[model samples]
Target: MDIRRLKEEIITYSQEIGIDKIGFTTADPFITLKGRLLRQRELNYQSGFEEPDIEKRTDPSLLFDEPASIISIALAYPSKMKTHVRGTKTDRRGIFSRSSWGDDYHIVLRNRLEKLEKFIVERYPDARCKSMVDTGELSDRAVAERAGIGWSGKNCSIITPEFGSYVYLGEMITNIPFEPDTPIEDQCGTCNKCLEACPTGALVQGGQINAKICISYLTQTKDFLPETYRSVIGNRLYGCDTCQMVCPYNKGMDFHFHPEFEPDPELAKPRLKPLLSISNKEFKNTFGKTAGAWRGKKPIQRNAILALGHFKDETAVGELEKVLKHDPRPVIRGTAAWALGKIGGKRVKEILSEALADERDPDVLEELEGALEKLNHETKA
Candidate 1:
């Protein structure tokens, strides 16, 4: 079979399987991506995943002991849901920054890639294939860029004119040699909106990101969040989208209406009061299948208290005080203390004093001190 014909067949089958975009590239993206990963690792910027075992990633030979080509695919997310933008910190709107508002992309994209793999096998029984969504050693964004799907933008995300950056990427590494696509040119051209819009200054110059400072990374990480970033977290509970929201390419794109991705009406713009009151069972029931469900309920609950603190919503002080004394997670307890401090009053002060006496974590202790200071200063006035 002609390699070009096989490539064409792959694209056709991918589209037939409901993928939004397809492209192909040679299996060596390490030449461009290795240095970036190394820098991230050296700076301790990586959230948890180690620098992809470089040999496995770069060596097309390792991917498929006899690999000849890589087929990359992208699926554009529907762009229709306008994220809520009420200025009030009290508006505990459950917002999903486009990419996550639907069914988990990892599951959706992997399923499609598996189907594509089966199709290739039926056509060429001799060909062996491996499929990966975001879990593989391969540099997915680099592969997508080389495949002509898009270019890596200043925010370090792949950006295509057709889908902006609101697309999921998947790939099939096969032993079937095929003609490769030419990479697209970078179109970012002097624009720095994504950088400026970043809430935590994660996006540094020249397209580099310190993931440790990234709100997206912070939201997903299981470790305690530093106090400095607590207030800036604002109302974002699961992930941050400020950078993507400001990108010019994302403008005017149609919203994705995939039924699997739709937000549960109760979850979409939930009341802050209800979110504060939810039990662990309720949290699981509400977000179990959603992408935000990862890291379980602790992080989201912590973020909710932080958001309330930032909002300085007095009504939340009673609930925040309850968690301050009894929440199992130190991070949640600390954030609750901070929230109560910000919502300072006689009752919030009493809770802070009690929490301070029992708190063992130094970090939580510091937060308690900060809260006490705020309360004392208010009393003096």
Candidate 2:
């Protein structure tokens, strides 16, 4: 079999099937990535979402027997919403980062990978392939960088010259000895824009992130947000885009190539107040198809309350009051108490005081007391 001819055919077929970019690399173990993951673990900087087993994460051979080469694919997603979804002063909205804009990229990328696998197997019936997206043990970014899909930018994103950083990455390991493509050189020389722009200083340095403080990671947590990060998270309900938005390479880079990735304006940037009271069924019916709903309604609703606090929306005080008094979850109840204080009103002190009497959870009671103190201080001033 002419392996070179097979690689070229795969590339041609990939473009026809809507894969924006395709590249190949030898399935050598990611030696440098192993050290990075170890250091991240030592520093306690990793988000708990990462694959815990470092060896499995860094070595492709462990996943598939005698893996000869790997194929990496990139699919460009839209960075901007086509139609502006407007919100009034009284009805401010929370934003989901561009990643969660449409149908989950996991499903979209997996479908593409399966098609590519079929195409390869038809030509070479003996081809053995294993594919995975972000959730997989293998680092998708590391594989993409090695395969020449794009240079790994300072913001920790694979920045393709044609697609910028707005691309979904996936990889497949195959027992075929395809020649590896040349990796792209780092282009973010002397540009500290992403580090400077990170709201929480999560970008510790170029190509390094402290996921513990990252607003994007924090938004997905199902616990009460640390008090310090609540304001820094601002109006984001799902993930943070400040670093990507500030990258020079990403300038003038918005692609609407894939219909599956197109954002519904209202869903991508929904009204903050309405989200405060959305039932689990309503949340599922509206956002279940999107990636942001993976952590379920609690995290989004908790973030929605925090967004309302960030906006200091007086109109949402009633909703906040209800959540504080009636929500079953202590985290939600506590977050609502905090938001009410941030969005203080004539009745906010009374609302907190009333909730304090019935609040049995120590955390919720503490939040209620703190909010009342803040309000008292403001009143005395």
Candidate 3:
């Protein structure tokens, strides 16, 4: 088979299938990524994937014994229509980053990659292919860069000139020995804006991130958020995008027009009152298909309470008080207490006094005391 002809055909096919960029790379990104992962492990930065089997991540040989090439593709999500900012008065409008404003990217990218694989199989009947999005052990950003699609920026995201960092990545691992593209030079010269813009200081020097301090990880984390990072998390209920938002490359990009990514009208900017009151059943029905729905209602509800706390919305105090005692998740209960404290006047103090009588969790008890202290100071004033 003529490799050049195949490369051109692959790129053409990818564009026809709605993929914005495609490039090929030999199955290795560990030259840069391995050190970063090791540092992250050493710093105790990994949130969900603690004890990440570094051998699996660093060695492409482990992913596929015969791995010869990787086809990296980028699909741009809409950016022009500021759906989050549109038609909403509440801060919850700003909760989710624009990347997550639509359907889950994993599903979108996986489906497209499967179709590409079918096309390749028909042409090369003897060849084998496997596709992975963010799920697998492959270093997608490194693959994309090596494939000449775009360079990785200081925020550690692949930055394409057309799609910016708003593009979702998908990869096709194949045994076919395709010609590899040259890795692009880093384009983030002297710009520390992404590092500066990080609310929780998750971004370190040289594009490394500590997941423990990352709002994206914190929102997705199953355990309680660290105390130091709580105040910095702000109103972001899902992933945080301050780094991308502050990047200059993302400017003037057209909004992604895929209907699959369109924001749900009800969820685009949910009212804080309704969000705080949503039942688990209602939460499932409302956001089951959306990206933020994966973690269920508790984290989002907890985040809503945090947003309310930031806004100091007195109206939320009553609801906050009620949830503080009865919410199944201690994280939710703890955040609710914090919100009540921020909005506290008379009712909040009464509720805290009531909670103190039965609250047993050390963390929740500490939060309760902080709430009471704030109320005591307010009352003395």
Best by TM-score: 2
Give the Cα lDDT of each candidate.
Answer: 0.78, 0.94, 0.78
Q: Give the range of the ten consecutive residues with the poorest summed lDDT in model 1.
A: 81-90
In order of TM-score, best first, we have: 2, 3, 1
Q: Decide which is better by lDDT, 2 or 3.
A: 2
What are the runs in model 3 whose C-alpha is more than 4 Å off? Answer: 80-94
Q: Which candidate is the best by lDDT?
A: 2
lDDT of 2 by residue, 169-262 (tens): 9999999999999999988999999999999999999989999999999999998899999999889999989999999898999999999999
Please say which candidate is ahead in TM-score: 1 or 2. Answer: 2
Tens-place lDDT digits, model 1, residues 2-28: 767877887888778888889888765
TM-score of 2: 0.99
Worst lDDT run of 10 residues, candidate 3, spans 85-94
Cα lDDT over the full model 1: 0.78
> What are the models' TM-scores?
0.92, 0.99, 0.93
